[model samples]
Target: MNKFLAASVSPALYATKANARIFTLSSTEHNIEVGNWKIDSTQLGIIDSFFSIEQKILHGGKQEGSKIIILTSPNGLTITLSPTRGMSIMNVTGQDIRFGWDSPVKEVVNPTFINLESRNGAGWLEGFNEMMVRCGFEWAGHPGIENGEMRTLHGKAGNTPASKVEIEISEIAPYEIKIRGLIKESTFKKADLQTVAEICYIPDTYSFTIHDRLTNHSDYPRDYQIMYHSNFSKPLLEKDAQFVAPIKEISPFNDYAHKGLQDWATYLEPTKDFDEMVFNIVPFAKNDGSTLAALHNKDGSKGVTIEFNIQELPYLTLWKNTDTEKQGYVTGIEPGTNYAYATSIEREQGRIRQIESEQTVHFKIKYSALMNKEAVDKAKKAVADIQGAQKTTFVHTPIAKE
Candidate 1:
């Protein structure tokens, strides 16, 4: 790799320079738009040519005008990100393995067609097919009336488009790539929050990290909640798949989930009209406040793990919807500051978090894929180590009073 000082150049200038290290795809503040473009190592003067980035716009029903960024890494890892949909991960594939689910919502519907207030505030489901989508920057959970306001499902962070998008690559050996986006959720006199979301990917690795920083730009204290809804299906998820984690305490979200308490960490085969089940968990962390969770296949030959800091995301929720394949059989491993309860109920339960005016909060999580049994075993051992000598407490009934 060539060693040069990192610099940003205008789109027109970058197109003519073979050594440009940064490119801006869209910027509202700068009034710049270089839509549908592609860049590779050759364009950046890198010795290796295994990395590439491409941006394209979808044209069709509900998906028309939506933009997507596809990233191909040297380690055979390909990730698709939707800039038109809050920069969420559309899907990820490594070698022959994939890390996303097949949802009934086939199209990546742009936010323009979503009516978040329709169907009693449940309109967020129309465009809910990403492998990993963010929920909340303000309030996240079930749709209901809270404090005279009709709170929509999972908030608006996932549906909100990025105001700016950029791609940057290091100019040295073992080059690192970062795809950054800026998303703002604000109101004139109510709330003002800005999120800087970045997906960092390194060469020769089957893992990626989501680094995000959220700031309150208002003049008064603000209440907020955020959850990483990472969903998975097939290959790594099946009739005998298991969810492993170092649990401190676990409880059913409601009566429906209570009936499946005995097999909370286990999954069943896809069945017709299967009711979804959810479990709230307080995970056990290591001395450094780091914890991890994994989902392994039946024979433990393949798996995936999510690693994060327990101090940043103190709660976890497991959602199992093993309905028919056509109905979108999937599971979600979510980590958040609070459980998935209505905003009003979470406030009463003292689960909603608050930030002072002009305060900023940072969060990061690593998602890795395990392609073989050895890797799967290693991930399971790490979770077991965190659980050493710790007993898990299971609550038999629903903990939240709806």
Candidate 2:
């Protein structure tokens, strides 16, 4: 037999759990599997050559007893998910572009571990720093009570641990490897909700998507409010950073937002006593079923574009909290089913949504970065199209008292 043929171990190949095909090589006749090579179905239109999922328990300050699930792609893209924090997306990074803010607290602690009820209801902000946090089901902001039941700021969804957590990876068409996470949030005789997130990465592309399915599991109908509080920090947000969106109507939650309305698209250097301002926005969606919002440095070399499903989540809230040199300096681009109002106010205004028993609502938000001129221009054009299609109106309302 030929030397190479004699070294062949077997005519059959093995498959890895990740669908990686492995071939065997041997040293001699009666050959053993001496060498093994892995072959993924790359030719099947997978964008990423390598994909991996890692889960670890976080330790150290504030993160003790918390769990983190990290998903990595071949192009140095990493997504961190916190199961303890309502399976929130804690970070999204690649190629030194940090789209999420890093908080002072290192650990994901249970809300019960913090004394958030103190300090006049400012305690819920303890774990407020995350990439994409969910605020809803009961209350989205401020301490409020309805029918003698009380809720703290932003509600307990962000802090409440998911009882059922699952992570799955599939090697199917239209994706190389897709990671899907299912987190279920339910309480006995209280709230029953679930958030299903599918992280899809396209082959040879730098963008990924977060498709979510939010379902209500309670027996009776219940009032539900949800807001996607996605935060961005430095590098992406700088002194001359510009915020572009297809805002159809803009208004201030208070005088602070009113003061910044004229220059709402511009950012300032960190300042003192910068009262956090909230701008309520009504965006105009293009034919693609998505509205664009972006924040980039003045040079426009690097930035992020968020394409949100405007059909499901119609309201957008922009938060500017450049309060101090530290522990502040962050901007939030939030889209939600209702305005960022307290449960009482939202209910009073009839802005809250009612989900019937066993009914589900879907929400989607896609994040893609603009690291070059072409990407930036594409975002600009998208914004211009949205802006040109509609006339922007202004609504000035008095701030709701906490």
Number of the predicted model whose TM-score against the real structure is largest: 1
* TM-score of every prediction relative to native: 0.95, 0.83
In order, the Cα lDDT scores of the candidates are 0.88, 0.70
Residue pair clashes in candidate 1: none
Q: Write the per-residue lDDT of candidate 2 for residues 1-402, one digit (tens) a residue.
A: 421122223455322345422222222234343222223334333554665555676667677667776767656577777767777888888876887875665457666576656656557788877888888755576676677766667766788665434333345544444444445556798778766545666544568777777677788887777888989887888787899998888888776678788888888877888788888888988776688898887788888888887878888889887766465688899888877766888778777888888888887788887877678888988899888857788876644544
| Residue runs of model 1 more than 4 Å from their true location after superposition | 1-9, 13-20
For residues 1-402, what per-residue lDDT tens digits would candidate 1 score against the true structure? 211112234546232133325677887776767888998876778876468999998899999999999998857689999989999999999886788999999998999999999989999999999999999988898888987999999999999999888887776767778887888999998889988888998866889999998999999999999999999998888998999999999999999999999999889999897899999999999999999999988999988999999888999999999999999899999999988888998899898999899899999999999989999999999999999999999998898866
Least lDDT summed over 10 consecutive residues: which range in candidate 1? 1-10
Clashes per model (N, Cα, C within 3 A): 0, 4
Cα error, residue 12 of model 1, in Å, equals 3.2
Model 2 compared with the native: what TM-score?
0.83
Regions of model 2 farther than 4 Å from truth: 1-48, 74-76, 172-182, 202-204, 287-289, 399-402
